[model samples]
Target: MPVSASYRWSPFCVDGVTTVAVKTLKENAAEVEKKDLLSELEVMKSLDPHVNVVRFLGCCTDKDPIFVIIEYVNRGKLQTYLRNSRAERHYGNTHGKSNILTSGDLTSFMYQVAKGMDYLTSRGIIHRDLAARNILITDDHTCKVADFGFARDVVTSKIYERKSEGKLPIRWMATESLYDNIFSVKSDIWSFGILMWEIVTLGSTPYPGISAADVMRKVRDGYRLEKPEHCRRELYNIMYYCWSSDSNERPTFLEVVQMLDKLLHTEMDYIELERFPDHNYYNIVNLSGEKL
Candidate 1:
């Protein structure tokens, strides 16, 4: 599914009906070479089943390339789906994507994401990468958090900081995270804000017209993206709160879930779900339908 230019993973359906995905590494010393891989495998294997979270099937770390098997979400990335839906509507090409997510659909999907993140943060797990593209959708309109390629479990009560050098999604990063390389549930909350924007805008690029190198400066200068034109005022208020300069000012995922629940105006906990692939198959597209 993903490669190690910056990541590694594989998603395929063995039977063409039941889908499965995996993360593999040279079995030789995978546990040693990439200790994170082992930790990730453990996280995957240990996750308690949840409606909003991706399901882990099994893993094989004993061989040359260790294998981490997980339930394959057929609809693929959320960003691509949004983009395609917008495009199909624009061009009137109602083939694979005709029905876009309604307000209720958006609310439910975001609530699911919040629930998944709350589960992880409650356990002190940090998803270093949190973005719409990392989220997957099933055929039945279920949103499942996917792609732990950059996830980590916080072993310390203190902040988790790294000194490594690599490219990162600057637009989606919190100010402290970009400057200090410190990651926490707070940083994740900041990312959740950006993710909400994505969902609201139907996959609009964050900080459009800004270069990645300059995003830090702009954000530092208090330049947050304005509310999406069609976004509800109440939801936009939540986004604003999420982008608070102070990490402590950001709401926890649990709080987010509660807020969304109130907005959704429902006490219902879960819904019936079924799995089906998105109509945008074979063209693994991005926010703009560009081939990945």
Candidate 2:
């Protein structure tokens, strides 16, 4: 669901065989919150459905608790799913599983996300927030881009400028986006690199132990995120391509898709999960805190 952190929601089963996710808001809720949800709904409605993008269902507005329905993803957030897979690898308990997440699976996930983003960018929609937590995994292991609350349609403007900022994604943001409030498809690509890092690292927090302010400062000073120990040089290079200091130097979503496609078709693995080092999951409850 494309909701803010304060939005309360839950999943319900239909006939005990199917499930659907619902985002509900009472009629008496603040106007800003309701407008946020409705705004996301409009963005979702503007695009054609894709296999890699979450499907939007119907909504109920003429009621006390307005409901926005969306296709339910069984595996939930990609970050949590990746973390669980890492746990399985850590404990050596990945048995009897036909679909244990492999290096290939991770590559496929990234490829799928790229394809989804490609579709969105082609439609002139910039997903201001593109990260692991905003993506969802399905029972069949397909990655779908979700949560369009921060998305904007730049079809006419070709760019989005932040008029008023409440909270911005600092760590995943591009250099221009961090330095200035400007956003574009290239900025989304920059965030994609960070998402690639999350997938390779099994949801490890980016710029671990650094404050959001420090992240902005370091990024502005030409400090890029280090490649994961298990990430291949070629894949890391692609990530570097996305994190270019100049937005114009960054690859387009289509170019990114093509690059990832080539990597996927290669016999060599780009990421080796077995080689991933053991590390504690850094949970950042507050992004504005001194340290993430």
Candidate 3:
């Protein structure tokens, strides 16, 4: 679960058998936001039982409290792992700390996330909030896309009105979402591109030291997040293509999956491996010894 920094909700394990996160609207905002929250909950109910997406166990709406129960992923949020890896890298370079995962581990994680997205998109559902903190990993390092609080039915018309807009994290939102006020499966693709960048950079903040407005301006000018030093050219190409200025230029989730699948299978040259010396090919090996 994400840290309770500015979050109003708190996560707790339930009955020693499940982990559930509860988000309580502020008293003043509850009356106004209840409908939207309920809408999301209903959508969750409709999409339950998918292995890639988080399960909605049940909910509670009583006199003074409202809560939704979800599957408990014990390994915590993907952001936690990314942050830990980044810290380890920093310390490892300066003080000889060990690395948690190499580049190959990152690649496997990305492949799993793409598979999850492909599954959701196939079901006609788009995960509007596809951020690092929203993805949960298992203790064995398998990924599940969680936090569907912002997800919506893809075919629903006018589900979000301009006036009803709340503050978006901005950085994670697509260019069309930020500028054209248009959102579609393509918008989710944009978020996925940023997510890929996060995986490569180990959860480095997008547009670091830049304001959201500036990011919008830069995106409008065709600027995108830069590729990290350790990233492969093929991977960078994929990310760049995903964030193309024209949404139509971006590949479909299925296409994204195919491209990543290909890259994951391609063998790296000795120079390539040495350039990313910390990367371990074994990290991509599944428990059964098959390539992921």
> Between prediction 2 and prediction 3, which has the larger TM-score?
2
Query: Model 1 reaches what TM-score against the true structure?
Result: 0.83
Query: lDDT for model 3, on a 0 to 1 scale?
Result: 0.69
Q: Compared with the true structure, what per-residue lDDT tens digits does model 1 show for residues 96-160?
A: 74575566777777888999999887767788778888888877888888777567777576367
Clashes of 1: 6
**Model 3 segments more than 4 A misplaced:** 2-16, 26-29, 92-99, 156-162, 269-292
Off by over 4 Å in 2: 1-3, 13-18, 26-30, 94-99, 289-292
By TM-score, the candidates rank as 2, 1, 3
lDDT of 3 by residue, 133-251 (tens): 78888777788887666677765552232344655657777777787777777888889898887777666667765666688899888888876666767888988988987889999
- Which structure is stronger by lDDT: 1 or 2? 2
Judged by lDDT against the true structure, how good is candidate 2? 0.83
Query: How many backbone overlaps does candidate 3 show?
Result: 0
lDDT of 1 at 124: 70
lDDT of each: 0.73, 0.83, 0.69
TM-score of candidate 2 relative to the true fold: 0.91
Q: Whose TM-score is greatest here?
A: 2
